[model samples]
Structure formats: C-alpha cells, structure tokens
Target: MADDSNTEYLLDASLSDADAMAYVPDPVEVPYPDLEYVSTPETADTYDKYFYFHREDVSFEEALADIRDCDSLARGLNSGMGYQDVYSPYGGLAGAAGGVIGNAIAAAIFGSAEKRRIRRVNLRRCMNFKGYERYGLEKDLWQRFNFEEGFSGEAEHIRQGAIIQQAKVASGPKPATEELGR
Candidate 1:
C-alpha cells in the first residue's frame, strides 16, 4: 500500500512579451440617419384663424325652463318652501301686518334680483353644456381636426404652432442644453 498524504501543488506566474500584448477587438461605430428640416410657409403667420364649433341657438322657452328649474332648486334648499313672510313678536295683528309689508318689499326688490341671479346661473350652465364657455374655442380645436371648409394648410400649421407654444409657455422654463466641449 502507498502512503499519499503529503501532496503539494505549484502555480506558474511568468508570461512571454507576445502573450502580454494579446489581441483586443476594436469597438464598432453605428451610423444614425440624418434629420431633414422642412421650412414653414410665410402665409402661416398672415392667416386669420378662429376655432369654430357647431352650437345651436337656445330659445326663450328653453331659457325660461332653465330659470324655473334653478328657482325650484333654490326653493328646495330653503326648507322646501317658497319665500316666507316675516313675523313680529309684539302682537298677532302686528305680526300679520309686518309679514304682509315684508313680503311686499321683498317681492318688489329682491324678487327681480333673485330672478336675475337665477337666470345668470342658468345661462352659464347652458353655455357650459353647449360648449360655448371660456376656453371652449381651444378645447374644440384640440378635440378634432375637423376644421372649417376652405381652411388652408398654412393656417393649420400656424394654429398648431400657437397651441404648442402656449403649452410650452404654460409648462414653465426648460433645462439648458449641455455644451459638447466644456
């Protein structure tokens, strides 16, 4: 039987000059496609553009109905009761007299004011629903490319540019571009 309990291992740490200068593959460069710039027409600046959308005229009856609806809602908010007469605590007859007088005064003054307020509210609601409110023009423009008949390409370009410019301005200042050689 052979005793193989004291085996030792050795490592080589020497390399030739040719082995030291081993070959390394060169990095390949990728070519990118050139971007082509198109000049916008001068007429784009001169053209008058307006965002137009289809809006039906509201009739007197429609306005009246809206006013009535608002008034009814107001009445509901006021404890489901119409205007109540003011009461005096001195006497029943005096209270009745005061109530009558107060009701007359309110009808004469506040009645018209209340009606006007309701009408205004109704008008605003109607305009909002019919897409006639403020900023509606811009909203209509962005909604679809369905421009009016005989609209020129130059006008469209100008309008789109204006919208883009407005959006950029609203978005605040952008980060500065970095220089190649600093």
Candidate 2:
C-alpha cells in the first residue's frame, strides 16, 4: 500500500504536532521544510491589529473549508436555534403595527455588537480545534488576503475569495511586533 502515514496525521492533526509543523523556519540556523517564507512591507502608517492562523502543511482547499465551516458554526450559534417563521405583517392597518414589532425583534436578534463578538470567539475556538495557531498582523495587511467574518455583499465576497485563492500557498504569518508598527 502507498505510504499514508503522514497523510493520515494531517486528516486528524492533533495539537501535539503543532511544534513539529512550524510555519516559519528558525532563521535558517537549523534544517527546515522547503515552505516559502513571507515578509511583508509596511503599507499603512498605522493599523488595527488582529490574529490569523497558519499551519505549514495545510492546503488551500483545507484552509478554505475550515474557514467556511467555522463561519457557519459561529453564526448559527450566535443566532440561536429558534425557527423564526416570517409571516408578512404588512397586510392591513393592524398589520402595520405588527411589522414594526417584527423589525424591532429582528434587529434585537441579529447583528448586535455582542452577537458579533460572540461569533468571533466561537470562530477562534473552532479554528483552534482544527490545529491552527494564531498569529497577529495589522488589520490592513490581513484584509488584503483573508476571509474575515461579518463581511457582506457579493463584490466583497468575490474579492476576498480571489485574493485568498491567489495566495493558496502563502505561508509564515509572523506575529505583529514593535518593529512592524502595529
């Protein structure tokens, strides 16, 4: 049989192997994988900071699937398990009042700041569970090539997907530090 010992490890990668799969080579002082090492120049004078994940052996398809699954899980958890049956309340005079109530209720349930925060936390947990480690970057730099949650509209979706796809083999997300100007 073909040697799948390594491939099997990838399918159910455990946190125990995290250190063995370092994304960044240790300054070339020691032997390392032939993975590409990326160094980005400063674009903006300042940046809002956030963390992203990196695993040396992950394929683009795996990363994209993991991100999508996490996004769905986070949103579903934040929105709750209620079956919100929408009945049009704009039918008559009394219905107008019901419409207003429906709007208020919807607003209260969806897209609140708290809900967004909870979603982010859940996303982080799910990604971590998949053996991804967090690395920090300036917000401006990250948005250039990542799939962030809470972004809407078709154009934005296409742009994000394209950039991420283009960088399918992108590796080595360095932590934002004092020198990087985060």
Candidate 3:
C-alpha cells in the first residue's frame, strides 16, 4: 500500500564524519559467546530480531542518510491505527459508539507489537534493497543501537540515532580479544 522505495529521502547537503559522530552515544561492545551475529536475507530469526544496516562502499555519512531514509520508510509503513473513514451506517449516539468500536477493532488488528515488528522488517527490507547487509545482534548489544518502532522513548530514539550514526563507522568485526585460557 506504500511506495516502499529507496529514493524517498533526498539529501541536499552532505554531512561531515565529525558532524555525524555527534548523534552517536558512547561506545558499546558485545563480547563473544553472548554475542551471536547473523545476516537476515528474508527476515530476522526470532532471537536475532535486532539488526543494523551496513554496506562496504558507503561513507559513514551516506550510511547515516540511508538509515534515516529507512527509518522514514518504516515510519510511513507503521503510522499507527488511523482508520479514519470508518463511519457507521447508524445515526447519532449509536453511530458514535460503532465508530469507537470500529476504531478499537482496527487498533487491535494493526497496532502494538505486530506493527512494531513489521516496522523493523520494512526497515531491513529497505536496507537490503539498497545494497546493505542486515547484521543481527543479540538483544543487549542491539539495545545499544536500536529501539522498537512503536515503543521508542527519548532514550530509545537516542540509541536509534547512535546506531544510524555508527553503523558504517563501526562497520566490521571487532578486534580479537585474548582467550580465556591464555
């Protein structure tokens, strides 16, 4: 029902790397064992629901712009329960009650957790289409950079921004750590 295209968000002025860094929070690391990474070609697996977009050729600023574009696309797809044209055939008080009931039904069917999950899916799909890989992370590490679309608080938005800004900059595997038995 939506355009669902990559060319939706246009960038006029390019941002410098230093400018992009301002949006990211402090660094975070997800050590091995607890940190399992996967790339979702279809969609994320149940436990590996968290993800960020990465591409080899893009600059950090370009990646940031793409992230914002995908976020916008995701938001457009999940703009929440607004079945505005749902008017009842009945008149007066009965019609008002029926409208309320209809709206509630729509919310139940399309709002909440499922919508948020779809938002994430749509975001990943967008990034995938734009030649980016979807790198999945375990929840704790994912939380450092992402927020559920429908449930984002101020902190979550900041975290989302953090990931958007950091995705390309932190693009590859972390450096090796000393083995436990070593």
Task: Look at candidate 3 and tell me the lDDT of residue 83.
Answer: 62
lDDT tens per residue, model 1, 1-182: 12121111111113232332221111111111111222234422312231211223533234323333432343212111235766567768888888777777766665554544443344345434543321112323222322221111213232222222222221222213211110
Please identify model 2 stretches exceeding 4 Å from their true place.
1-49, 76-111, 146-156, 159-182
Write the residue-wise lDDT of candidate 3 on 1-182 in tens digits: 12222111111224453453345323243211223444344433443365555566675556666776776677635546766655667778888878888887877766767678777778777877777765455465555445564534223334344455345333445423211110
Compute each candidate's TM-score over C-alphas. 0.29, 0.43, 0.54
- Clash pairs for candidate 1: none
Better of 1 and 3 by lDDT: 3
Q: How close is candidate 1 to the true structure, as a TM-score?
A: 0.29
Residue 6 lDDT in candidate 2: 17
Instruction: For residue 156, give model 2's deviation from the true position in Å.
Output: 8.2
Best by lDDT: 3
Which ten contiguous residues of candidate 2 have the minimum total lDDT?
A: 3-12
Instruction: Report residue 8 deviation for candidate 2 (angstroms).
Output: 34
Report how far off residue 15 is in candidate 3 (Å). 16
Task: Compose the digit string of candidate 2's lDDT tens values, residues 79-124.
Answer: 4423344466466666666766776676566645455566667867
Ranking by lDDT: 3, 2, 1
